[model samples]
Target: MSATVSPIREPLIEGGKSYHDITVDLVRSTEKAPTRLWWIAFLISVHVLLFGVFCILWTIWHGIGTWDLNRTIGWGWDITNFVWWIGIGHAGTLISAILLLFRQKWRTGVNRAAEAMTIFAVMCAGLFPVIHMGRVWMAFFIFPYPNTRGSLWPNFNSPLLWDVFAISTYLTVSLLFWYSGLVPDFATIRDRATGLRKRIYNFLSFGWTGSAKHWQRFEALSLVLAGLATPLVLSVHTIVSFDFATSVIPGWHTTIFPPYFVAGAVFSGFAMVLTLMLITRKVLKLEQYITIGHIESMNKIILVTGTIVGVAYLTELFISWYSGYIYEQFAFFNRALGPYYWSYFGMMFCNVVSPQLFWSRKIRRSLWWTFLMSIFINIGMWFERFVIIATTLARDYLPSSWSYYVPTWVEIGIFIGTLGLFFTLYLLFTRVAPVVAVAEVKAILKSAGDQYLAPNTEHHEEIMKQYKDAEDKGKVYGSDHAHSESH
Candidate 1:
């Protein structure tokens, strides 16, 4: 396709980075010593992770009795954190798979980090269900593998059991999708690296060469994995919603949970992506690649999904009242006016009220504002889960069993620990791989890059087009330029 005139678009890539400069700029952080800021962030995250690990061990030794899970509230912080992390992880595959399939060039700026976030977030999320099991060692029972005792089989009918398959499959496919995109980038580092680092990256990259055949297979495999991952994005969260929606509890059993949860997942997921991205772009000196345009684009998603979530929230309430189900009515009423009213309001303010700021383009484009709001949205998402679980579970069918639920210090620690663990992994990831997709940024640089950086001259555009044309024909371009550049 040829570039045509349009209303002038902001350059997705700033600073006129050539294909070579993209490699250098993206890989520079990995090759150098950790900055003071990097160490400070890493250490803080590590300490938080350690605190979380201690809490996990304490929970394991003492059992969930350490948690404040009462008779009425069997699922509290653990389940809430589980859902929150899972929702947070959704942006990765959404960026990598869904955006890739749609051919959105903007995804190049953030998809690599988002995909990594999905993997790490899922790791943090998977912890909750296992630990919440009370007996941590028997966590494997959720797996559908054949048991030694023939009669004692995993419950196929259980939604919790469905989570095992759905999440595992999602993780596996996401891992593949994430790693596949990293191969050429890894190879880039390998070529640029020294003895030991070169050897390591060479192994990681599986000896990738800038051959026509290699790029051909890489693109093909990416599509296949994206095709596999796209459905998992929708299905994994829908199955997660079943954990609540399939329940008999008044507010819990509803047809709305599937779409509600999916929208909420994408909402929170995009918010999280923005939060991490804002920080990442700053710390890594990647402003040229992860530009303000990327920020505005993602915020648009947050606006759309946040609006969907707001409607879902209203729908849940309307359905309860309009259905004339006394139990459902009381469930939502308790959430608003009952003991947990504080959390309910927080949820509404953060998820619904706050994201509405993005209706103003200036607000969406502002870094400080977007970062601040991202934090707000995530906190609100946690509140939303809490309201859903606590309000519904705390007051049940039997009045005598009704009680207020509060998380123990242990629950809060584990949740914070997961936060720490997530950041710790992400901080470490910056050292090991290019946070931005190096190959992909190059792929779209001509078309989507800044106005000045675009091939305004015939010579430059032709140089860029040779690579694009070969890529389209599934053959590598010539060695007239750098091998990695053409690759």
Candidate 2:
């Protein structure tokens, strides 16, 4: 006797959508005129971004002295916001490149938006270091080039300079990977377009004809880029951590900073992704494409990364105590019990304690709760940066030199401006580009759609045997009727 096997479970794409339906749904947002809601959000983002630009201009005109930087705290909100934006960018690469390499198909629903977020977040991150240079005009000095001013070159030993190379390389590679994925989708749009739109998409598509060779190259390139990006995602943050770890500062210098920073980055990055995707799904009506399953999967990641970050926090405290170093121990204690202790506790609550709610299946599946938690995670991560940078610097080794650092209005404006800039770009991207990867989503149609079937060999054989037995019974009945009629 044979037991029956169950078929594969639920579909990734719900509502029984076809390949054409997927294309239509994704491209519809791009083709339609901007909604009132879109315009409202865009204007708000622009307003904030412009304000940030004004603040940046003010800083450049008056010099870096316009802000709160002083002898005791050379890096304050500028570096804090820089690290925050950089960490937020990491989730995009992790979702798009790392998950792709791991063969995680669920990534297809979120990768396009996540990749865009990464690019925009990096753009925001790059601005801080550049503007932090008082003479923004002389920012090119950070790059190594033969110049008339002797043989002056950027110091290769400095992790700051390493950031120059690492960030630039990461940005370039990420752009290529993102655009490569877009080409096929661009071609889809091009084929459906006419006149000027047609011409624009045609150029964007690079004459893609959907040929077997084009797809072959596309897949090969995606795999290659994914491989390159997997190590890159790790290396970029690791190098960023190096900027602090290599320093002589007590709290900053630690062997655990690399993994600690990487985990924190992933945590913050996923939070931002959830925040954006939740809104996108609701506004753009993409529930069928980005289902509850996708949201739940991301929540699990947030839970994992958040826990890892919480452990790192505890470990740092433990290591400081165990080392019995005066400065190190004082720094950790200062972070918790000092003047900025509120920020530390806030970070702990948001990053460490909040994500634990995901352990409940109900909360993970609830849209509103997920969104609220994502916001909390973002806040916690920001406070984490504040605790790391400001608190550590506010109380230095010497009591005489210790001073509190507060962000001036200029610094505040610029940080707020970067937020505006990020949203502005993202809002525009949603309007013009496919928020969902059309081709990638299409590729998964067979496995994710309603028409999917189980290919269990045992079940197939059992069904075949039942059909043969029925046929034999019918033949026997027919033979009996013929004999009875003849008699």
The stretch of ten residues in a row with the least summed lDDT in candidate 2 is 1-10
Estimated TM-score for each candidate:
0.92, 0.92
lDDT string, candidate 2, 1-487, tens digits? 1123234444567777877899999999989999999999999999999999999999999999988788988888998899999999999999999999888878999999999999999999999989997888999999899998897998999999999999999889989999999998889989999999999999999999999988998899999999999899899889999989999999999999999999999999999999999999999999988989899999999999999999999999999999999899999999999999999999999999999999998999999999999999999999999899889998998899989877889999999999999999999999878999999998877766644533443456788778678767775566567678998
Off by over 4 Å in 1: 1-7, 451-487
lDDT, model 1: 0.91
Candidate 1, residue 438: Cα displacement in angstroms equals 0.3
For all the candidates, what are their Cα RMSDs to the real structure? 9.8, 9.1
What digit string (tens of lDDT, one per residue) describes model 1 on residues 233-274? 999999999998998999999999999999999999999999
Candidate 2 deviates by what RMSD? 9.1
List per-prediction Cα lDDT, in the order shown. Answer: 0.91, 0.91
